[model samples]
Target: MASVARQARSAPAPALLSIGQVLAKLSPEFPDLTPSKLRFLEERKLVAPARTASGYRKFSSADMERLRFVLTMQRDHYLPLKVIRGYLEEMDAGRTPELPGGAVAAASMLSAERKLTRDELIREAGASPMLLGDAISSSLIVASDVFGEDSLAVLKSLVELQRSGIEPRHLRGFRAAAERELGLIESALMPVARRKDASSRARAAEMAREIAGQLEIVRSSLIRSALSRLDS
Candidate 1:
């Protein structure tokens, strides 16, 4: 079986894009995208762009699509890079792996995310405008003209919580808890983050994701334990 790199290299040929070209194509959609982020994605094995004799990176069309998928998952779903890498590995092996959140199929990698308008977001989430406004006010969701799937998911959860008589205001502490976790991640990442190289920055990003994944596991376990106690 070919390695992931070999598989990427063996894809149907198209005009390969330089890193700058890749940035040009992707930057409009991902304003925070930088060469370092691209390198970080590559380091995480999420993408395997071809290299020139001078060791410069060149992305094939498939590579570009793969990078887009990885970035989308990270930005929209807040998925860790390792999780994204595993999904891609399965896809490279010709297996249709389920997306982590089951939001969409792996095949959706080739397409752009469906940006939802404010009204559309509320409609899809089966949430009322008041509920959405409350979520924004609670700092659980940001106010924006156009929302992404994440916002829709949050609003949907808010609607369900309302059924349980839980309001967004009741979850305000979640934002502060998230900040605390971020502070922990930043502290853990300081060693790598201090380095001003692309490689180190990439490593720091990957480390942050791994730390966040661990924290999520701990949080979920605590919730389950508390729920079990309540049942008992």
Candidate 2:
């Protein structure tokens, strides 16, 4: 054990990372993490990376972990920046603060979603470029250089549907239906949005998710009921 400890102590420390390096390392999990976004987070003081002799940003391993925590909280819980900062401040003061989303484990602090490039997405989803083109043109999917996990899932389902001879063209009405549902959600949120507080905005976002979930349930039930009539 002492020999192992000695070897561990002799190990090299993690290298400090540059901003571009940080983005490249993290963008797979946080596809939206551009340099501008990182700068914005730094401006908000959510993270405090060190500076090199020439003033370049240098991020230590601890800084990377802190950033992962902050981004996970923002992405998963939709916590306001002030709230996240306050939690971090509590931790810095040596107090164990509760996580905003009732998180029970440290793993919850590292909720990075999957990200894929356009070609990678197609390969992973078993989809053809023509299908992707049709999906985009029909508004079934938005064209992007990088896609989130949801986009991959959608494309995979489309691939299965394609095998069954159901094409993206057949799903064109989905976009209009989704837009109408979004309109409803927007109308519902306007009152809360007008309040202009961070708390209000957070609440509105949560409520909007809940309402969208309910709308999805209703839509699913309607489709199932219509299918039941055909079976009858």
Candidate 3:
């Protein structure tokens, strides 16, 4: 199968854009984007811009679209570079693969997810006001006037867990556990986060998310193993 790099070159190409132009077009939506970050992304092979005879980078409109898709995944899903690259590779090879972080959209290129009001959140999550209050008090979820899609998902899951007699208050330790994991991630990222560039900060953010994803997998696996023991 042809690699994404080769396939990216297979199209009826648009006028090539310079790095500054790419930054200009993208920076409004992604304020922290920088030349160094673009270079970092290219280094990760998440994007493969064409090169000039003198090695100047040239980006096509297709490349821009791909970059937009990639940035969207990273920003919304917090997916790792490797995962994003794999997803791109799968698409390039004509396969419809599941997105990492449980994203169902085949392409979120045009996705601008909504933020819901408190009442809207409760209605959409199928949760009661009291349950949401309890969840907030127990630190299982944050108390926000406006909530994101992820907040709704968490609230809905809490509702299901409540049916199993696991109230939000019973999971108070979860917040502490999450904080402990966060501390570890922050410590590990200190080396990168200490850097004085926006690119380094962006890189650190992605790395933190990648580590968090791995931690979540381990946590879920351990829970499954414990449940299996109960069944046995």
Candidate 4:
């Protein structure tokens, strides 16, 4: 019976990964992850690994890929877990998932081939003309012949703020704060970004975006905590 059980566990299944193996494979990519975190991800239904006869969880190659995708979305996108799960589901179904823009989206918008005129940006962002002008003057939005989706998103946020008695002028400090953060990130990446390979350069860029996303998460959490205190 022991031999039968052993055989059952070892039967030519598609390559199964032990917990240690999984950690070894993924740790470099997600330095902060631990066994508990992997389990937590499983609890959240972000990953479902196969179970061996001995009841040990065995991750398949597909499971590893799914995990990579999930971690990438969270670290790089600063997306809520639920949103990342939805995107993963779409991808699993062979669909091209549209990722959220966060700050990287803002940067991309500035480089888009087509730009929106000031009126067009305001119309798309649902913002007022004065608010757009304020954003421009504050350096939040550059005066460009065209605007990208990032500009539109920023404009939309500005419109929302306006309803809450916050205006573009109130956010003037944001640009200065962002510049400081960017300096820190650039300094941290100096080693990797200095590499000559295209792949390394691309990876450094992704890492920069991921770091920015994490920072955004921290900032948002801090703001929410402060707001809660006010309510109390």
Report the C-alpha lDDT of model 3 over 129-172, residue by residue, as the tens digit: 99999999998777888887778888999989989999998899
Q: What is the C-alpha lDDT of each candidate?
A: 0.85, 0.81, 0.86, 0.78
**lDDT-sorted candidate list, best first:** 3, 1, 2, 4
Query: Which residue pairs clash within candidate 3?
Result: none
lDDT of 2 at 42: 82
Model 1 per-residue lDDT tens digits across residues 1-232:
4698899998886798998999999999988789988887776688899889999999998998788888877766567888988988998999999886464534345466678998899889999999999999999998998987668778988999999999999999999999999999999999989999877877777788778888989999999999999999
lDDT of 4 by residue, 30-142 (tens): 77667776776787689999897989999999999888766766664455566667766887799986765455633543442346887888887887788888999988888
Please list the residue runs of candidate 2 whose C-alpha ends up more than 4 Å from where it truly belongs after superposition.
1-111
The segments of candidate 4 whose C-alpha lies over 4 angstroms from its true place after superposition are 1-115
| TM per prediction | 0.81, 0.55, 0.81, 0.53
Supply the TM-score for candidate 4. 0.53
What is candidate 4's CA lDDT for residue 14?
81
Ranking by TM-score: 3, 1, 2, 4
Every model: Cα RMSD to truth: 6.2, 9.2, 6.1, 12.2
Instruction: Score residue 165 of candidate 3 by CA lDDT.
Output: 94
What is the per-residue lDDT of model 2 for residues 107-222, given as tens digits with 9 covering 90 to 100?
Answer: 45544466789899999999999988898899887888888766777899999999999999999999998899999999999989899755566567556766775786698899
Q: Model 3, stretches more than 4 Å misplaced?
A: 1-16, 51-56, 103-110
